[model samples]
Target: MGFDEKAQNKAQEFQGKAKEFVGDKTGDENLQADGAADQAESGAKKAAENVKDAAKNLKDGLTGN
Candidate 1:
């Protein structure tokens, strides 16, 4: 994936981690769940981007681009 996407994914993961930590400290189950959801969403996004990038590379290689 590109640098921008990578950075965004990292930021999202970090935000989730912070939320989870705060939720644990504050004893908020909902916040903890939200944090976990956020991390999962970010991971999905990154995986999608990686797949797209791999597809593009495969196409380029096939076309000798």
Candidate 2:
């Protein structure tokens, strides 16, 4: 299957971890910052997906789906 929002966000989080690890090993401040930003963005995306899913569930419940 194509990447869903959850999968995309999870992949992004793993990528951030890899970057952070590389930055730490290489002593690259910019890379570290970028990795942190990526992680934050991933977290935000996950939160948004959660909200959307919750909304959909609520709507479905109300509509007897």
Candidate 3:
């Protein structure tokens, strides 16, 4: 099956949240930082996806989708 970018991003976001929670519970500073970084990366990817689709839509509009 083709990879779903949205699903991937959501999964990453969820994972980051879980890690952040676990790290906080365990008092692991490194894990918490990693989780925060992961969350940022996932958010950036989602934003990129939004930009990509918007560009595609603009192209389609110009060409008639």
Ranking by TM-score: 1, 3, 2
- Cα lDDT tens digits, model 2, 1-65, are 23685688888899998898899899998888888889999988877877988999999999999
lDDT of each: 0.90, 0.86, 0.88
Per-prediction TM-score: 0.83, 0.80, 0.83
Single out the weakest 10-residue window by summed lDDT for candidate 3. Answer: 1-10
Clashing residue pairs in candidate 2 (N, C-alpha, C atoms within 3 angstroms): none
Residue 37 error for model 2, in Å? 0.9
* CA error at residue 59 for candidate 2, angstroms: 1.1
Tens digits of per-residue lDDT, candidate 1, 1-65, equal 67897899899999998888899999999989888888999999988988998999999999999
For candidate 3, give the lDDT of residue 43: 87
| Best prediction by lDDT | 1
- Candidate 1 lDDT at 49 equals 88
Clashing pairs in 1: none
